[model samples]
Target: MSPDRANPPETSLTREFLAALTTFGAMGYVVVVNPQILSVTGADRHALIVITALAAIVGSLFMGFIGRLPIALAPAMGTNTVFAMAVAGSGVSYGTALVMVLVGGIVFTLFSASRLREQVVMAFPEAIRTGLQCGLGLFIAKLGLMGGGLLTRDGHFGDLREPSVMLAGAALLATPVLLALRVPAALLLSIVAVTLIGLLVPGAHGDALTHLPAAPVQMPPWPSDYTFAFDFGSFMNHLALALPLAGYFFLGDFFSATATLIGVTRRAGLMNADGKLPNARAAYLADGLASMVGSCIGSPTIAAYVESATGVETGGRTGLTAILVAILFTFAMFFWPLIAAVPAQATTPALVMVGVMMMEGIRHLDCSKLENTVSAVLIMLLTVTTGNLVIGLAAGSFAYTLMALALRIRVAPVLLLTDLLLAVYVALSALTLHH
Candidate 1:
């Protein structure tokens, strides 16, 4: 048989449909989360839809066509909240805030285009990289908890209560049951099912669910005053805040993107004949561009999602999967109202589940190797407890570097730079609580 003939088909439409559906299922958290963000920001929902759709299209093109990786892109949850509540609330107009995001996108593009993103990723020892993924996984899970109200703010002392407990419990139960039943889009299906039952079954508690339907998709507005207007004066007002947004938001993007790429690559089993990542520059560029597009739309920054990892688990190995997912995302834009029905409780379960899956990265660490163990534990702990990726990363790198130096292991100067950045941020956050 010819070698070319032996290759599996990578462009099946039916396969792509299934792939996209699965990818959509994985993205349930974002689907549920972003609308709330837009509403809170007081931005026009229709404009947010346009921005989200464009990000998906631009991102899919970058990943599927350019990077040839099966990944989806959209607004990041953590960064969006910061932009709305913190940045927007502090006096920076939405337009000026978006400019910062665009600037961030440009930085990511330049770094990624030069493949410096790849090098920065590579500079980390394999153990640290793996741990970072695990940390992000935990971070995502924590977000599910916080968002679902499973973890709530209590006066002086905090504890999980009744409704938060109920919703969280329902979602957690629903996902595995659907998965075991071989349900397609198990994560998303479970969320909807739980939300419906919770709403109809009596005593639905905490964050009421609203029925949503598929709506027609709309085009993004021309970069304009409403969408693209950037105010130089307001930009300067938030210049200091811009650094935090740049540092934490970019790190979050990098970590999420790395985790998404690694998860999909491993599942595709498309190891380079040498067992390495493929066309990483193309992948990172797509990621950077997606963020750029998202910013232009007045939404939060975009990043690769962990839910897409579940698509990989389902035998998705081609760009068609991402393309299919993008189509679903397009359809979702219209059904924003219907899709918005999911309560945080129903969805947090899936987030927690994905987090469990991501936590597997910890197994790769060698605690017996004190440095590796310390770094891994520190990264995971700080990521979960602090709810800050960059800070956790900084602490982990700081510990890792100190260990490396003390043990007389040769370390790279790039790592030193990473540690330096992390240290400075950690110190500042500690002193000012700006983080």
Candidate 2:
């Protein structure tokens, strides 16, 4: 047999489909959750859901075709929080807020298209990279544990006997076993198994955990209030108020997408031997473009989703995996209730399992250096505690830079500028995004 023929073709199509299914299972909650968040602006709920799916579809397509990685994209939770609470809650119209998102996307897309964005990402030390990876992983695991019904957000245990908790437990236990046995599509299988369990078993109220919609497939509504609904006039009228908000969206999207891309690609072995990300420009450009397209379609700050790790954990390595994700998003738009039926609890195990797999990056860190250890640990710890990837990276970068300076080590000028900008964003977030 020829040596060239010995290599597998990015795993089988069946595995790619399974990986995409696992990814969708992990992130499907966004279809429901995003609408609720955006509805704070008084947008129509039905419209938001449809737009949310559409945003995912568009972003995933960009990532699949341009970025060409296993990662998927969707409306970001953090930026949406900012858009709803800070931008819209302050009394700007939802349309005005979307205008801000649109402008921000344009700015990010422009910057990402240039090599400067890649340079900024490459300037960071490996410690920061490792921290970003381990941090996002831990945060995901925390999300799983919190949503599994066995634990509160503040670290307390919930009613352990709750039916949801029990079901999550079943999945939590089952996923690891499937993984250990090297089963194909283990995470996807675990999610399906748990969903079936939810359908059959009686809960605390003595009813099935999931109540299926009478009709599984319903045509999605075309958004009347949000699609191409930018209030550019209102945005222009409120330039003083709108400009800063747009700046936040632009800067935040830049950093958050950068962190997610670096973390997920590194996890997928997509980084070059020199430890720099390959196709960083296209990946970032796709991320920025996704946000722009999403904002126009009534979503906010669409970028690469961290939950794409679940697909990577299942042997996905090529863009085909992301294409399948886009395909699933298309189905999700049409079959909203069917998609929604898979509750957060069912997918908690896959997230938890994928998160566990993500922690493997830590072992490869340069533990011999105290600075590296401290910076990486700080990033991982703060990332979870703060529930923000960019914030965690900023904090770790500052720590790393400070240590380097104190030791009289030379730091890149680009990194110094990035740290300064990140520090400003971190300070402002306390009063805005995370507020």
Candidate 3:
């Protein structure tokens, strides 16, 4: 690829802007979904919406300006779910959870600044990395289907008679057809089409649209309620609880961000000849800083979101795309009502399509090696089944290490150490469950 093709200049600003808009359309669901998930912790729903947007804005801006990457950032799905369901639901105060996030962010920053983060990334074999990408892809698609109500809890097809399901089905079918026709912003267009259909159709609840917001316009208020609300007393009083939760937060953020940066950058042809991402430390710093900012503003730990691939797929090659995403997130704050009116089903197609795109990494794996193939497949299966990326990665890493040792293959010492650490993490998690 030529220099212009690798890093397009401002001459391609229009294309970059459109790519960013496509990314926003694909990922804008986080504006509503984050608050819905975190509100389980006794958080005010309105307050969470503002905080979530603010976090995304800050994180994306950092990625654009400092990291100089096309990656967008947001409060991650799995971490937020764990924060609400495991941390707060387990009787820990919300403020204490924020403290855990803050501490975890600090730890993450330290790790990224040192050799530890690089070592971990280096220890991951090529096959395992490909597996991680494929697993995350499946995970993203599953989330889309589940959130859109296209798939039932038991993994069966949802009732298509339902208006939401029908709309989602239309989106699911329209996305690929549009892409095949080489339509620009096909994902975004499918979302808009389904949203319009949703608005016209009466919903299952006898409403104009069951998932639409009550109002279509509203001014967003600042989330003063949660800003700087960390409870040091609660955090310090429960070292045992805080330590484990903090570890979970740290590992989840670190691994997810690492995987996203690697997968997205490789897909965009940003990796160097040595398979290392250039200026990766800067990206990691941006991710860590985003998490810290999120904790301060009463949101979950923010990280580099894999959905940024949607923009990259659309010819986004530089920080310009991320800057545009940050601007849109800032604007989205004031358009909460309009955003909320677009149901989750409308965004389902984009997520599913992005997942399909990410799955292309599987082709790079050496499937002829049985150990590599088995580990990769296990990673994808466990990720979708357990709904946890950390668990899936850890399980796959351990399996890969053991299989390599049994086959008398030369294994990196770092990988063996990583397997030990993962074993300890799993044991701790099991103990926490029993407690």
Report, for all candidates in order, the number of backbone clashes. Answer: 7, 0, 0
Q: Worst 10-residue stretch by lDDT in candidate 2?
A: 1-10
- Deviation in Å, model 1, residue 274 alpha carbon: 4.6
Query: Taking the tens digit of each residue's C-alpha lDDT, what string does model 2 give over 373-429?
Result: 998988888767766555666778898999999998878886686677677666665
Model 2 alpha-carbon drift over 4 Å, by segment? 1-49, 63-104, 204-206, 223-284, 300-325, 386-394, 422-435
lDDT of 1 by residue, 42-98 (tens): 666545555666666667766777666667777875566556644434445777767
Candidate 1 residue pairs that clash = 20-325, 212-337, 212-338, 213-338, 214-335, 215-334, 215-335
**lDDT, candidate 3, at 257:** 84
Off by over 4 Å in 1: 1-11, 36-54, 68-70, 76-104, 125-132, 155-167, 180-182, 201-226, 229-241, 244-259, 262-266, 269-279, 305-318, 426-435
Tell me the lDDT of model 2 at 188: 66
lDDT of each: 0.65, 0.76, 0.78
Best by lDDT: 3
- Using TM-score as the measure, the top candidate is 1
Model 2 scores a TM of 0.69
